[model samples]
Target: MAITPPSNRLWWKEPIHGIELGWIVIAFLWGLFMFFFMIAWHFIGEQNLSTETYKVKPERYQERVEAFAAEFQAQDADGQPLEENGVPVVRPPVGGDAYILARLWEFWPILELKKGESYRIHLSSADWQHGFSLQPTNINISVHPGYEHVVTLTPTGTGDFGIVCNEFCGVGHHTMTGRIRVVE
Candidate 1:
């Protein structure tokens, strides 16, 4: 009986030296392309999106309130008046200007508002960019120097909400604080 030796397999069929290398290279290039594509999308697509900055003046609040009230009144006679959580909505004086002279380490009079009443706050920085933060609930916002920031707030419960500056402004940035009283 004669014994025959087995022939070596082709490079394409061999376990470690086959077409697997080509597949690996293709996978690696595809992964690189995907990574770069994602990076490009992040830079190009995200850069075009606009951030909203709401500005308000002392006089605009009254005008807006009156407009809102008029709209509310025109809706229905027997319908509920914008009451949230069973609390009546209180509208501030219509078409009246409330002056807020921005100062360091102080918040003019500090507001006391009724629960469920929508209050519009017209904020602007006189000196520099200031961070307005209402605490416990942790509502933090930014006000640019010479630019106005308008925010509407309605407290759900009766409590003392502290308004603190979260941004570094000047020497008294740490001492800058205020309070909002939410009544029954």
Candidate 2:
């Protein structure tokens, strides 16, 4: 004789059993609710995470220099031709090291800035090509030799911003990294 479990009893084995059907229905509804809730939350939260567009160009720094020189010359008392060394200084709002130069596999000193202050970064490669990428904000800019690239950043929050090289230079390319500390 074969042994039969209590669950195989007539009452429990019936396909129309109210309790079993109720439980199945309840589980299906709960799963549907959870799936919809997750999708709704994702769509709602992603709206607040938009990013601003930034450009990377070889002529940006040169353009900025020319614009500043023109502006200063216009304001000069004698309207003299703009001298390269006499370009008016536009100090970074956060006031740390404003210019940084580095080689293919190295980074200059890290920068620290305050929230809501404008920072002007003048970057140029000493040797080969390199890329400047600021993470969490996802700003990827390129740096090349013989051309200085200018980037302006205003930290919206207080945290550490990572700088990574996205270019494939020679050996030690994986070790190229830097950081920007944003203080409150």
Best by lDDT: 2
The runs of at least 3 residues in candidate 2 whose Cα sits more than 4 Å from the true structure, single-residue gaps closed, are 1-97
Root mean square deviation (Cα) for candidate 2 = 11.5
Q: Work out candidate 1's RMSD over C-alphas.
A: 14.7
Displacement of the residue 50 alpha carbon in candidate 1, Å:
14
Clashing pairs in 1: none
lDDT of 1 by residue, 1-184 (tens): 2275346534456566568678999999999999999989977773432233455553454345445444432212676564433322333433322222245765543455668766656666656678877788756777665555555666789988887888888999888876666877
- Count clashes in each candidate, considering only residues at least 3 apart in sequence or on different chains: 0, 0
Tens-digit per-residue lDDT, 38-101, candidate 2: 8899877653322323344434544544453344332235755423233232223453325544
In order of appearance, the predictions have TM-scores of 0.49, 0.49
Clashes of 2: 0
